[model samples]
Target: MNDIDAWVWWLVGAAALGIPLVVTAMPEFGMFAVGAVAGAIVAGLGFGAVAQVLVFIVVSVALIAVVRPIAARHSAQRPQLATGVDALRGKQAVVLERVDGSGGRIKLAGEIWSARALDSDRTYEVGQAVDVVEIEGATAIVI
Candidate 1:
Protein backbone atom coordinates (compact mmCIF):
# COMPACT_ATOMS: atom_id res chain seq x y z
CA MET A 1 0.00 0.00 0.00
CA ASN A 2 2.84 2.34 0.84
CA ASP A 3 4.43 1.66 -2.58
CA ILE A 4 1.27 2.81 -4.44
CA ASP A 5 1.31 6.55 -5.06
CA ALA A 6 -1.38 8.84 -3.60
CA TRP A 7 -2.20 9.97 -7.15
CA VAL A 8 -3.21 6.41 -8.04
CA TRP A 9 -5.61 6.34 -5.10
CA TRP A 10 -7.17 9.65 -6.22
CA LEU A 11 -7.67 8.36 -9.78
CA VAL A 12 -9.29 5.19 -8.41
CA GLY A 13 -11.64 7.34 -6.35
CA ALA A 14 -12.50 9.34 -9.48
CA ALA A 15 -13.37 6.12 -11.37
CA ALA A 16 -15.48 4.97 -8.39
CA LEU A 17 -17.42 8.26 -8.44
CA GLY A 18 -17.94 8.01 -12.24
CA ILE A 19 -19.84 4.70 -11.90
CA PRO A 20 -22.78 6.33 -10.08
CA LEU A 21 -22.71 9.33 -12.44
CA VAL A 22 -23.26 7.09 -15.46
CA VAL A 23 -25.91 4.93 -13.78
CA THR A 24 -27.97 7.70 -12.19
CA ALA A 25 -27.32 10.50 -14.71
CA MET A 26 -26.56 12.82 -11.82
CA PRO A 27 -24.35 15.80 -12.64
CA GLU A 28 -23.22 16.15 -9.02
CA PHE A 29 -21.37 12.86 -9.19
CA GLY A 30 -19.59 14.02 -12.34
CA MET A 31 -18.62 17.18 -10.55
CA PHE A 32 -17.21 15.11 -7.70
CA ALA A 33 -15.31 13.02 -10.23
CA VAL A 34 -13.83 16.21 -11.66
CA GLY A 35 -12.85 17.18 -8.13
CA ALA A 36 -11.14 13.83 -7.67
CA VAL A 37 -9.16 14.47 -10.85
CA ALA A 38 -8.09 17.80 -9.39
CA GLY A 39 -6.99 15.97 -6.25
CA ALA A 40 -5.05 13.52 -8.39
CA ILE A 41 -3.27 16.39 -10.08
CA VAL A 42 -2.38 17.92 -6.72
CA ALA A 43 -1.05 14.58 -5.44
CA GLY A 44 1.00 14.06 -8.58
CA LEU A 45 2.52 17.50 -7.99
CA GLY A 46 3.82 16.31 -4.56
CA PHE A 47 1.20 18.09 -2.47
CA GLY A 48 0.36 16.61 0.95
CA ALA A 49 -2.81 14.56 1.57
CA VAL A 50 -4.57 17.48 3.36
CA ALA A 51 -3.83 19.89 0.49
CA GLN A 52 -5.13 17.39 -2.08
CA VAL A 53 -8.36 16.85 -0.12
CA LEU A 54 -8.86 20.59 0.32
CA VAL A 55 -8.42 21.18 -3.40
CA PHE A 56 -10.99 18.47 -4.15
CA ILE A 57 -13.57 20.02 -1.80
CA VAL A 58 -13.01 23.53 -3.12
CA VAL A 59 -13.25 22.47 -6.77
CA SER A 60 -16.40 20.41 -6.24
CA VAL A 61 -18.18 23.10 -4.26
CA ALA A 62 -17.23 25.77 -6.79
CA LEU A 63 -18.48 23.72 -9.73
CA ILE A 64 -21.79 22.98 -7.98
CA ALA A 65 -22.29 26.58 -6.86
CA VAL A 66 -21.67 28.05 -10.30
CA VAL A 67 -22.93 25.38 -12.69
CA ARG A 68 -26.07 24.32 -10.80
CA PRO A 69 -27.79 27.70 -11.17
CA ILE A 70 -27.09 27.86 -14.89
CA ALA A 71 -28.28 24.28 -15.36
CA ALA A 72 -31.47 24.99 -13.36
CA ARG A 73 -32.20 28.12 -15.36
CA HIS A 74 -31.88 26.23 -18.63
CA SER A 75 -34.03 23.32 -17.42
CA ALA A 76 -36.74 25.65 -16.09
CA GLN A 77 -37.19 27.38 -19.44
CA ARG A 78 -40.21 26.43 -21.56
CA PRO A 79 -39.79 25.86 -25.30
CA GLN A 80 -41.50 28.55 -27.39
CA LEU A 81 -42.95 26.05 -29.89
CA ALA A 82 -46.73 25.58 -29.73
CA THR A 83 -48.03 22.40 -31.40
CA GLY A 84 -51.42 21.15 -32.71
CA VAL A 85 -54.43 23.15 -31.41
CA ASP A 86 -52.22 25.25 -29.21
CA ALA A 87 -50.55 26.52 -32.39
CA LEU A 88 -53.94 27.60 -33.74
CA ARG A 89 -54.88 29.89 -30.85
CA GLY A 90 -54.54 33.58 -31.69
CA LYS A 91 -54.08 32.72 -35.38
CA GLN A 92 -55.97 34.28 -38.27
CA ALA A 93 -58.54 32.28 -40.16
CA VAL A 94 -60.72 33.07 -43.16
CA VAL A 95 -64.43 32.30 -42.98
CA LEU A 96 -65.28 29.68 -45.61
CA GLU A 97 -69.00 29.84 -44.80
CA ARG A 98 -71.31 32.04 -42.74
CA VAL A 99 -69.87 31.77 -39.21
CA ASP A 100 -72.03 32.51 -36.22
CA GLY A 101 -72.60 31.06 -32.75
CA SER A 102 -74.25 27.95 -34.18
CA GLY A 103 -71.01 27.01 -36.02
CA GLY A 104 -69.89 27.08 -39.64
CA ARG A 105 -66.65 26.48 -41.57
CA ILE A 106 -63.34 28.37 -41.78
CA LYS A 107 -60.01 27.89 -43.51
CA LEU A 108 -57.50 27.80 -40.65
CA ALA A 109 -53.83 26.89 -40.95
CA GLY A 110 -54.37 25.65 -44.50
CA GLU A 111 -57.15 23.31 -43.36
CA ILE A 112 -60.93 23.58 -43.19
CA TRP A 113 -61.99 23.55 -39.56
CA SER A 114 -65.35 23.75 -37.80
CA ALA A 115 -65.66 27.22 -36.37
CA ARG A 116 -68.02 29.45 -34.39
CA ALA A 117 -68.05 33.09 -33.32
CA LEU A 118 -66.82 33.89 -29.82
CA ASP A 119 -69.78 36.26 -29.49
CA SER A 120 -73.00 34.47 -30.34
CA ASP A 121 -74.56 37.57 -31.91
CA ARG A 122 -71.46 38.33 -34.04
CA THR A 123 -71.51 36.94 -37.54
CA TYR A 124 -68.74 36.50 -40.12
CA GLU A 125 -69.37 36.36 -43.86
CA VAL A 126 -67.50 34.13 -46.30
CA GLY A 127 -63.92 35.31 -47.05
CA GLN A 128 -63.87 37.53 -43.94
CA ALA A 129 -60.82 37.27 -41.68
CA VAL A 130 -61.31 36.28 -38.03
CA ASP A 131 -59.00 35.53 -35.13
CA VAL A 132 -59.16 32.11 -33.57
CA VAL A 133 -59.63 32.49 -29.82
CA GLU A 134 -59.57 28.88 -28.68
CA ILE A 135 -60.35 25.26 -29.57
CA GLU A 136 -63.15 23.29 -28.00
CA GLY A 137 -63.24 19.66 -29.06
CA ALA A 138 -62.87 19.71 -32.85
CA THR A 139 -64.22 23.26 -33.18
CA ALA A 140 -62.39 26.56 -33.38
CA ILE A 141 -63.86 29.45 -31.42
CA VAL A 142 -63.21 32.67 -33.29
CA ILE A 143 -64.04 36.37 -33.23
Candidate 2:
Protein backbone atom coordinates (compact mmCIF):
# COMPACT_ATOMS: atom_id res chain seq x y z
CA MET A 1 0.00 0.00 0.00
CA ASN A 2 2.84 2.39 0.85
CA ASP A 3 4.85 1.48 -2.26
CA ILE A 4 1.94 1.82 -4.76
CA ASP A 5 1.24 5.36 -6.03
CA ALA A 6 -1.91 7.19 -4.89
CA TRP A 7 -2.59 8.32 -8.49
CA VAL A 8 -2.76 4.66 -9.57
CA TRP A 9 -5.32 3.98 -6.85
CA TRP A 10 -7.38 6.97 -7.92
CA LEU A 11 -7.33 5.86 -11.54
CA VAL A 12 -8.44 2.39 -10.44
CA GLY A 13 -11.27 3.97 -8.46
CA ALA A 14 -12.32 5.94 -11.52
CA ALA A 15 -12.45 2.75 -13.60
CA ALA A 16 -14.48 1.03 -10.85
CA LEU A 17 -17.00 3.86 -10.78
CA GLY A 18 -17.26 3.85 -14.58
CA ILE A 19 -18.24 0.16 -14.63
CA PRO A 20 -21.52 0.86 -12.84
CA LEU A 21 -22.25 3.76 -15.15
CA VAL A 22 -21.94 1.45 -18.15
CA VAL A 23 -23.88 -1.43 -16.58
CA THR A 24 -26.72 0.49 -14.92
CA ALA A 25 -26.84 3.55 -17.16
CA MET A 26 -26.96 5.78 -14.07
CA PRO A 27 -25.49 9.25 -14.53
CA GLU A 28 -24.37 9.49 -10.91
CA PHE A 29 -21.68 6.87 -11.46
CA GLY A 30 -20.31 8.94 -14.35
CA MET A 31 -20.19 11.98 -12.08
CA PHE A 32 -18.33 9.97 -9.47
CA ALA A 33 -15.92 8.75 -12.12
CA VAL A 34 -15.17 12.34 -13.06
CA GLY A 35 -14.54 13.09 -9.41
CA ALA A 36 -12.19 10.14 -9.17
CA VAL A 37 -10.29 11.46 -12.16
CA ALA A 38 -10.02 14.84 -10.44
CA GLY A 39 -8.58 13.12 -7.39
CA ALA A 40 -6.11 11.30 -9.62
CA ILE A 41 -4.97 14.63 -11.07
CA VAL A 42 -4.37 16.04 -7.59
CA ALA A 43 -2.48 12.93 -6.55
CA GLY A 44 -0.38 13.01 -9.73
CA LEU A 45 0.47 16.62 -8.85
CA GLY A 46 2.06 15.28 -5.63
CA PHE A 47 -0.71 16.36 -3.25
CA GLY A 48 -0.91 14.58 0.13
CA ALA A 49 -3.29 11.65 0.65
CA VAL A 50 -5.76 13.66 2.74
CA ALA A 51 -5.84 16.42 0.15
CA GLN A 52 -6.50 13.92 -2.61
CA VAL A 53 -9.39 12.34 -0.69
CA LEU A 54 -10.81 15.76 0.12
CA VAL A 55 -10.62 16.75 -3.53
CA PHE A 56 -12.48 13.56 -4.45
CA ILE A 57 -15.24 14.19 -1.90
CA VAL A 58 -15.66 17.85 -2.82
CA VAL A 59 -15.77 17.14 -6.54
CA SER A 60 -18.20 14.23 -6.18
CA VAL A 61 -20.58 16.13 -3.89
CA ALA A 62 -20.48 19.26 -5.98
CA LEU A 63 -21.15 17.39 -9.19
CA ILE A 64 -24.06 15.51 -7.59
CA ALA A 65 -25.61 18.64 -6.08
CA VAL A 66 -25.32 20.68 -9.23
CA VAL A 67 -26.29 18.05 -11.81
CA ARG A 68 -28.85 15.79 -10.07
CA PRO A 69 -31.50 18.48 -9.87
CA ILE A 70 -31.05 19.41 -13.53
CA ALA A 71 -31.31 15.76 -14.55
CA ALA A 72 -34.45 15.38 -12.40
CA ARG A 73 -36.02 18.42 -14.00
CA HIS A 74 -35.40 17.08 -17.51
CA SER A 75 -36.74 13.62 -16.60
CA ALA A 76 -39.81 15.15 -14.93
CA GLN A 77 -40.61 17.12 -18.08
CA ARG A 78 -41.88 13.90 -19.68
CA PRO A 79 -45.29 14.07 -17.94
CA GLN A 80 -46.14 17.09 -20.06
CA LEU A 81 -46.14 14.72 -23.05
CA ALA A 82 -49.33 12.72 -23.38
CA THR A 83 -49.28 8.95 -24.08
CA GLY A 84 -51.61 6.01 -24.74
CA VAL A 85 -55.34 6.68 -24.41
CA ASP A 86 -54.69 10.09 -22.92
CA ALA A 87 -53.23 11.05 -26.30
CA LEU A 88 -56.46 10.03 -28.01
CA ARG A 89 -58.51 12.68 -26.24
CA GLY A 90 -59.33 15.74 -28.36
CA LYS A 91 -58.09 14.00 -31.52
CA GLN A 92 -60.26 13.73 -34.60
CA ALA A 93 -61.81 10.43 -35.65
CA VAL A 94 -63.91 9.30 -38.63
CA VAL A 95 -66.97 7.21 -37.92
CA LEU A 96 -66.53 3.84 -39.65
CA GLU A 97 -70.01 2.72 -38.56
CA ARG A 98 -73.09 4.56 -37.27
CA VAL A 99 -72.09 5.82 -33.84
CA ASP A 100 -74.89 6.10 -31.29
CA GLY A 101 -75.37 5.78 -27.52
CA SER A 102 -74.94 2.00 -27.52
CA GLY A 103 -71.71 1.29 -29.48
CA GLY A 104 -70.06 1.66 -32.87
CA ARG A 105 -66.63 1.90 -34.57
CA ILE A 106 -64.44 4.74 -35.69
CA LYS A 107 -61.03 5.17 -37.34
CA LEU A 108 -58.93 7.03 -34.83
CA ALA A 109 -55.32 7.98 -35.52
CA GLY A 110 -55.22 5.39 -38.33
CA GLU A 111 -56.54 2.67 -36.02
CA ILE A 112 -60.00 1.21 -35.54
CA TRP A 113 -61.48 2.02 -32.16
CA SER A 114 -64.86 1.24 -30.52
CA ALA A 115 -66.75 4.49 -30.18
CA ARG A 116 -69.84 5.96 -28.55
CA ALA A 117 -71.55 9.34 -28.96
CA LEU A 118 -70.82 11.94 -26.29
CA ASP A 119 -74.52 12.72 -26.15
CA SER A 120 -76.81 9.76 -25.66
CA ASP A 121 -79.42 10.90 -28.19
CA ARG A 122 -76.97 12.18 -30.84
CA THR A 123 -75.99 9.75 -33.60
CA TYR A 124 -73.12 10.07 -36.05
CA GLU A 125 -73.49 8.50 -39.49
CA VAL A 126 -70.70 6.59 -41.28
CA GLY A 127 -67.83 8.76 -42.63
CA GLN A 128 -68.82 11.59 -40.25
CA ALA A 129 -65.82 13.33 -38.69
CA VAL A 130 -65.97 13.65 -34.91
CA ASP A 131 -63.68 14.82 -32.11
CA VAL A 132 -62.62 12.32 -29.48
CA VAL A 133 -63.87 13.68 -26.17
CA GLU A 134 -62.36 10.97 -23.95
CA ILE A 135 -61.44 7.35 -23.63
CA GLU A 136 -63.43 4.91 -21.49
CA GLY A 137 -61.97 1.40 -21.34
CA ALA A 138 -61.28 0.46 -24.96
CA THR A 139 -63.91 2.87 -26.33
CA ALA A 140 -63.49 6.41 -27.60
CA ILE A 141 -66.24 8.86 -26.66
CA VAL A 142 -66.81 11.26 -29.52
CA ILE A 143 -69.02 14.17 -30.64
Q: lDDT (CA) for every model shown?
A: 0.96, 0.95
Q: Estimate the lDDT of model 1.
A: 0.96
Q: Tell me the tens digit of each residue's lDDT in model 1 across 34-106.
A: 9999999999999999999999999999999999899999989987899989999999999999999999999
Off by over 4 Å in 2: 18-29, 79-87
Q: In candidate 1, which residue pairs clash?
A: none
> Per-residue error at 129 for model 2, in Å?
1.7
Q: Which pairs clash (backbone N, Cα, C closer than 3 Å) in model 2?
A: none
Predicted structure 2: clash tally: 0
Lowest summed lDDT over 10 consecutive residues: which window, candidate 1?
78-87
Off by over 4 Å in 1: none
Each model's backbone clash number: 0, 0
Candidate of highest TM-score: 1
TM-score of 1: 0.90
lDDT of 2 by residue, 3-75 (tens): 9898999999999999999999999999999999999999999999899989999999999999999999988
Question: RMSD per prediction, one decimal?
Answer: 1.5, 3.0
* Per-model TM-score versus the true fold: 0.90, 0.74
